[model samples]
Target: MKYSTSPTPSLNNYPRSTSPLPAPANYQPTTASAAVKRYKYIRRLFKFNQMDFEFAAWQMVYLFVSPQKVFRNFNYRKHTKSQFARDDPAFLVLLSVWLFLSSICLGLAMTLTAGKVALFVLFVVFVDFIGAGVVVSTLLWYVSNKYLRRDQDGPDVEWGYAFDVHINAFFPPLSLLHFFQIVLFENVLFRETFLSCLVANSFWLASIIYYLYITFLGYSNYGKLVDSDLPMLQNARVFLLPLPVLVLSYLATLAMGWNLSEMLMHFYKMRVLQ
Candidate 1:
């Protein structure tokens, strides 16, 4: 009996089956493209998560030292968005280390020059630089985030985590400067020279005004994601909202010091008149 059998399969021209199809030929993934693709995917998946404070802190420190980075991101939309998204705890910790190191070095330098009149001037100048830092920190985030809004896909919201991160990181520098000006100077340098006290007074006054302005601005615009959403600046009195009672309380203490000084001067004048 002749049984018809299927023609023997030929090795040539027959499709070879493997465990799985090899990745397509002509699918060339260069490193740059892969990185870019990865970045985009990560950005979308990113959330403030539990690490938001840490991320935001690093961003503040990074942007503080490298204004150029913020500026570049301002010009480039992708960078701004990526930056805003990846803000996480690990990054903030690194930044805190850097800011802490910076603060320590500044404090040490101040310590080394503790008793010198020239040191007082340097301290005064240093305080001014600290004030500048505050302005720059606030400005970099405000501007970078503003630029990010240009092509935003959804409603703009303040990354509260980032804002908090910044506040936490920023408070250190501000507090350090305040300590140097108030306690350090008052205890050591103020009695040395009239000029020293005058400079310290100016620094203190400037600091008070600066703090009030920044605090007011922070609360007034705290939840405002858009410019139009801002309450009328004149009518809103947004400044009163952030409980600056602590700051106000501090101011009251200073006022009492001034009043006591005035009373002493008045008593001295009466004695001379008698």
Candidate 2:
């Protein structure tokens, strides 16, 4: 967070990097399918020394404050490594660790038993984060290549990149609903008053909004590389297809007097109980 007396590259035309990052060791700019790249990426999971966690931490910080700057690196990766998906597993590893820690904190705040807390953490880290991530990423990957792309012959959106987008978008929401929401859960969000419902659901609304915006940003920048001639691309908000439905759902939740945080607490307890 320290200001440096250094000039960084401008974010305009970032996808076309003027100063690309130095490629990782053993990296080569080659056109490869996401599946193949994922195979190589997974192999490095156990190798702790090669991961750049400091850079990952920096990226995480910017993701909250200035997500645009964070994604500029993704474009740089494509410039140097021929793919938008990251090669290092450091970010994924850190996210999982954060997810685990946050889940524990949430479970404890809910006053669950130690065994139940363990079960809740397991469900969150595995089911909510990893399992659901695969489904969302695969769905977006399919949609981008099928409908979003100009044609079958054009460069397809990589599946790994779709997953990256999902995780990148997922981080802020997780911090909001999991970390920040839980911090306020015991005092504010778990109540049954109208204010409680509004505040709790507002967090839900904001979290989903953050997710959608970041997801759109991920695809929007990529869309610039592909054919942006579609009539929808006239406005800069071309990728925000879900905002209306999201707003409607948020309104419905408020009208129904649902406390989303309380619901989350009950859901976690139910998951552990069963």
Candidate 3:
């Protein structure tokens, strides 16, 4: 359902205003309790052209730091998305395959190390998957709320909010996880299989750097490669830029030195494996 707040602000003839509007005293940040409420909140904001880079930036900070309000402000029952890319189950299947393959290869390598460090890397992989799950779910929820029934002056709610939350949540964990996973795989596998690990590592590194570049410099660089722009970059920044977050999350897992998988495996081996 399409819900409009104020009329669309003119993007074509945007007025040059030096000052941004001060946040209203009553304006408190919050998250949506359900996907539908989040949809309406974003839809209303985008429709009024209130959804912009500035708003997106703040939203990212709020999501992690103060999620309750962010969720609460969302008008749950009235929310709906005009379209959802994941509605195509084929795409979700492809994503699951890609994620599973990436995780397993890394896990196998870490297992071969025959040391506590290798075990640690395996734990990182598990956390990375969990983080990725959060990113995908949150973004999909927001995307479904976007009103694509008609074009407006600004981005749809999906573009403005979905990408932001996804990137912010996923990036840090994915990056750090990739590094350890690749390292363990290389050490365990013979020289022949090293090339596959290398290739995956390169892709992980490249995606992270690319994510950062697109954030600072517009995604136009991507347009250079594909001869067309990819909206993922712009839409994603509306949250925390998922790449960096995924990268950092990996680092955090490593720093903590918590081998979640090993712990679970140990418990299972003792309780069930025997």
- Measured against the true structure, the TM-scores of the candidates, in listed sequence, are 0.33, 0.83, 0.31
**Cα lDDT, all candidates:** 0.40, 0.78, 0.39
Minimum summed lDDT over a 10-residue window in model 1 is located at 18-27
Ranking by lDDT: 2, 1, 3
Could you tell which candidate, 2 or 3, scores higher by TM-score? 2
| Residues 66-180 of candidate 2: C-alpha lDDT, one tens digit per residue | 8877766676576467877889999999999999999889888988889989989989988999999999999988877777765566467777889988999999999998898
lDDT (Cα, tens digit) per residue for candidate 3, span 1-274: 9799988878755522222323221122334333765465545543533334444445335543553333222212112222211111222233334455555554544353334434444444455444655566464544433522123453234342344334443443343444444555444323334354344444455555544543333221111112122322234334335666667764564455434333433442343223
Best by TM-score: 2
The local lDDT score (0 to 100) that residue 116 gets in candidate 3 is 43
lDDT of 3 at 198: 46
Separate clash counts for every candidate: 4, 0, 27
